[model samples]
Target: MHGPVSAAWLLVALCAATGAYCLLRMRSGVEEQRLSAGGEALMGFGMAVMAVPTAVFTPPRWAWPLYAAVFGAAALRTLWAVRAAPRHLHHLVGASAMVYMALAMAVAPPGPHHAHGGIGVPLLTGVLLAYFAGYVLLAGARLVPAAGSASGGGSTAAAGIRAGAAGWGDRPELARACRLSMGIGMVTMLLTM
Candidate 1:
């Protein structure tokens, strides 16, 4: 229940909630939205698992390899589907990050040694930070109401806002917020390592 652990748990809860919402949204048959929903669910769930406190349950030696393999498959799937849905490239990056973390943690020497490994932990951390930071910024921009639009009464802008509100009710915005939250979470986790 210390500050860092508390924050990590909060991130995990946020990710789980987002994943659940995305899965619910997938029930709707919109193909494009469904693709995004699926990616969000995967990202959320993966991050939640990654953020779990080691004290709560240290992953067994086999678990890390299994996780890496699963995420490796996910990365391949993302690459194959990237042409169909370009947003999946982001999913690929997230999955790749998971793979990197899994492998890094697996090979990392036990005990009080630094978190950096022989395989360029700093480089991996930098890449993840940049990707997540960009995602958060772009997603945040998408969530904001455009300037001079809110003031025009009954304009397309207003309609857009209404649509956004409806979308928020549907939880896409919430999912985006969760992504941003996860990005922050990942950065925090990386820094702590």
Candidate 2:
């Protein structure tokens, strides 16, 4: 992630935490949730690893290709899963983006001017940035309880408390929050790339 060490560390924390939460979400009784959570967990952890500052530890020459291979496989898996549930399409996009970033890094190792120089394709990066930005906005909007729903003692706070009352894997709000955080983390990583 060729950036300030502090920003890198922050991204690591955000991604790792989101990954851990997704791991917990795998226990969901819902098969769809389990499948989606697994992919999201992989993405979160992968992003965390990739976000590590170059000053701290420079990955070996082979590492970038390995990343690409892993994410490419993930993208394939998501593609297959999308046949059953269209929601998995997002996972496919996320995995593909990861693959793109990995290949970009492999082509051009991090340097002072890597962001503007030879890191990633400008057009593709811009597309990804737009996609994730829109996703973050849409997800954030969904998180807010509707004004009408907030009436009848079903205020946003009350709804949140009810959602939190459920078990980890069953908490829809938490799951959405986890996804939202990952979206923000992805945007941050892409910007740094």
Q: Estimate each model's TM-score.
A: 0.81, 0.89
- Candidate 1: worst 10 consecutive residues by lDDT? 165-174
State each candidate's clash count: 0, 0
CA shift at 113, candidate 1, in angstroms? 6.6
Q: What is the C-alpha RMSD of each candidate to the true structure, in Å?
A: 3.6, 2.7
**Model 2 lDDT tens row, 157-178:** 5565677755657677788888
lDDT of 1: 0.71
Q: Candidate 1: where are CA atoms >4 Å away?
A: 1-3, 112-114, 117-121, 154-172
Model 1 Cα lDDT, one tens digit per residue, 33-122: 676777667777877787777667566778889989988998888899897768667777878887888887788765534457445558
Candidate 1 lDDT score at position 61: 76
Flag regions of model 2 displaced more than 4 Å. Answer: 110-113, 116-121, 155-165
